[model samples]
Target: RRAAAAQGTSLYEEEEILLALIGGKDYNDDSKCKKKLEEYCQGLENASLKKKEIHEKLKDLCEVGKADTKCQALKTKVTKKCTDFKTQKLEQAVKNPSDDNCKENERQCLFLEG
Candidate 1:
């Protein structure tokens, strides 16, 4: 995180969440790392906003081309409280990649964590 921040790169949600999974921080009810999850949420919110802006820009530029659904959906998107259950499950899968069941879970975790 320090390296990335120093380089002007972001820690990103995945990295933060990974840190939480690895017991990098101390917290009560650490079963699900809230701080890490919050970072990811912030990142996602920022991304959703950026995507919305890009979609509008694209729509303006094209005039007759396809507009970005990602942006469009975001415009009318509903914010919801994230359930930590999913992350909890996936974090274990990622850490224990040696497990046979984790093979597919790891693949999925990579996708989700990204």
Candidate 2:
């Protein structure tokens, strides 16, 4: 719980729900689940960093009066892509909660929703 909290994600709740769904059976090893959660958190952090970088770059461009059509288009495209991806993942998770892939989708959706 501390680790997930440090990562700025509520993964402990997700883990508990996952464990319940699996009838309390461990995922091969508890460490594997922890490792996976850590990886997911790291991935989320990296994505946020990238988003910040993009925003900063865009801001810098605008401040210098060089904000071009392409830059705005790219930003809009990226935003749309992110929204579409989240929606798709959430729909997949909701449509097939019992599928193996949907378990991962659920985690991704939960993180994105948060």
lDDT of each: 0.37, 0.43
TM-score of 1: 0.23
Give me the displacement of residue 110 in model 1, in angstroms.
1.5
After superposition on all CA atoms, what RMSD does each candidate show versus the true structure?
A: 13.6, 17.4
lDDT per residue for candidate 2 within 18-114, as digits (tens), equals 3323222322344543444344435546776444554232223222323233233433443464577667765666676676655445444443333
Q: Pick the candidate with the highest TM-score.
A: 2
Task: Report the C-alpha lDDT of model 1 over 4-50, residue by residue, as the tens digit.
Answer: 45556443443223333432333223333334334444554676655
Q: Model 2 — which ten-residue stretch has the worst lDDT?
A: 19-28
For every model shown, what is its TM-score relative to the native structure?
0.23, 0.27
- Off-target runs (Cα >4 Å) in candidate 1 are 1-65, 74-98
Pairs with backbone N, CA or C atoms under 3 Å apart (clashes), candidate 2:
none
